[model samples]
Target: MIVLDFVGVGLFAATGALSASRKQLDIIGFVFLAAVAGVGGGTIRDLILGVGIFWVLEPVYIVVCGGTAAVIYFTAHLLESRYRWLLWLDAVALAAYCVFGAYKGLLVTGSPVVAVVVGTLTGTLGGILRDALANEPSILLRREIYVTAALLGALAFVLSDAIGLPQPFSACAGFVVAIVIRGSALALGLPLPTYRSRPGREHGAIR
Candidate 1:
């Protein structure tokens, strides 16, 4: 769990730094965005669960986020496509965070439904915040399977645990489910169907 938390924080922080890079922001911006993207979701989860925030307790997570930002700031220009890197890194982080968040939720509440919701939020909220702050297109606005992937991954973990699976195995199962779904969406352009109003419908007209 500790390892997953660190990995997810670092990767998400890197994505935040990449967003800063795209915006041509300064080092301070990189650090700020990275820290927010790294800890935003988990902070919300801990707050909702009435637990001590993870970073507030350890502090290493913030250090990791800052370090990740510094690294990306120095090397991001070398990449031919920073957006591609951000997408893939965010996908992996989302996978890991979903499992970590769900595990934490289960520990606190022992409720599968809460676990799933918290896991999904943990996986996606940081990126959502990052994009909003960066003035980029929100991932939630994309017609892809981003949030759905996280939700299904969390559900997978809870279901696997309920079926008496080992903790590590269940975590792996959730991570795999999330990454596979997200990766496929990235690679194959899989998208969710969007709602469309009927052509003959008038705006704001009641049925």
Candidate 2:
């Protein structure tokens, strides 16, 4: 679990740095964005669970974020498409975080519902914060299977554990489910159906 957390944080930090690169931000900005994107979701999850923030408890996570920023700062320009890198990295982080976040929530709260919610939040919030900070389109606003993928990942983990699956297996299953869904969305341009009002009833009177 610790390894999973570190992997997710590092990838999220990379996405943050990539966003900063797109904006041509300075090193300080890169670090700032990386820190937020790396720890934002976990921080919220810890607070909601009434536990110490993971990165605050172990400052190495912050160092990881900083190191990722520095590396991307030097290498981001080499990428032919930073946006593509950001999307794929964020997808991987989302998958890892969703499973781990659900695991944490189930450990701390013993509620599958809360686990699912926390998992989704943990998976998506970091990228949301990063995009907002970078003045990019919010992932939540997209029609793609972003939040749904996270939610399903969390559900998969919780369900697998409930059925007596080993923790490691459960986590892996969840990650696979999430990544497959998100990757399909990215590669196939798959989108969720959107609301469409009737032609003349777009502004129907409210009750």
Candidate 3:
């Protein structure tokens, strides 16, 4: 699980650097963005779960993000397709972290619902923070199939674990589900339905 968390940190750090690049930020900005996007979700999760901060306890994760930012800063010109790369990389991190979060949630509490919520938060919170800091349109605001993917993936992990599946296998299953769903959304423009307020209801009176 620790290894998986580090992998997620690196992947998310790259996405954060990509986000900073899109805004024409400087080297410091890149590092800041990478650091936040890499561990923001996990930090929040730890806080909510009343545990020690993961990266604070293991400073190597911060080093990984810093190194990733430096690399991205130096190689910026080579990434003509940075946005696409960021999207895919973020998706991978999201899925991986979702499984990890679910696992941790199960450890902290026996409630499957809470575990699923934690999974969703673990998958999307970092991206949310990145988008907010960058002043970009967030995935949560769009009807794109983002959180739904996380939810299903988390649910899958929790259910699989509950049914006595091997831990690693269960995590893999959840990760695959999230990545496939998110990838399909990216490739096919698949989206969840958006609510449309009725004309009469807009004024708080039913027709």
Candidate 1 residue-wise lDDT, 1-207, digit = tens: 787888889999999999999999999999999999999999999998899999999998999999999999999989999999999999999999998999999999999999999999999999999999999999898867899999999999999999999998999999999999999999998997757664555767856
Q: Write one digit per residue (lDDT tens) for candidate 2, span 65-90.
A: 99999999999989999999999999
Candidates' RMSD to native: 2.6, 2.8, 3.0
Off by over 4 Å in 1: 198-207
* lDDT tens per residue, model 3, 1-207: 776687778999999999999999999999999999999998988887888998888898999999999999999779779888888898889888888888888899878998999988988999999999998899687656988888888989999999999988898899889999988987888887666763334655635
For model 3 the local lDDT of residue 142 reads 67
**Could you tell me how far off, in angstroms, the CA of residue 143 lies in candidate 3 after the best superposition?**
3.8
How far is 175's C-alpha from truth in model 1 (Å)? Answer: 0.2
What lDDT score goes with residue 161 in model 2?
Answer: 97
> How does model 1 fare in lDDT?
0.94
TM-score, each model? Answer: 0.94, 0.94, 0.92
Q: Could you give the candidate ranking by lDDT, starting with the highest? A: 1, 2, 3
Candidate 1: residue 126 lDDT (0-100): 95
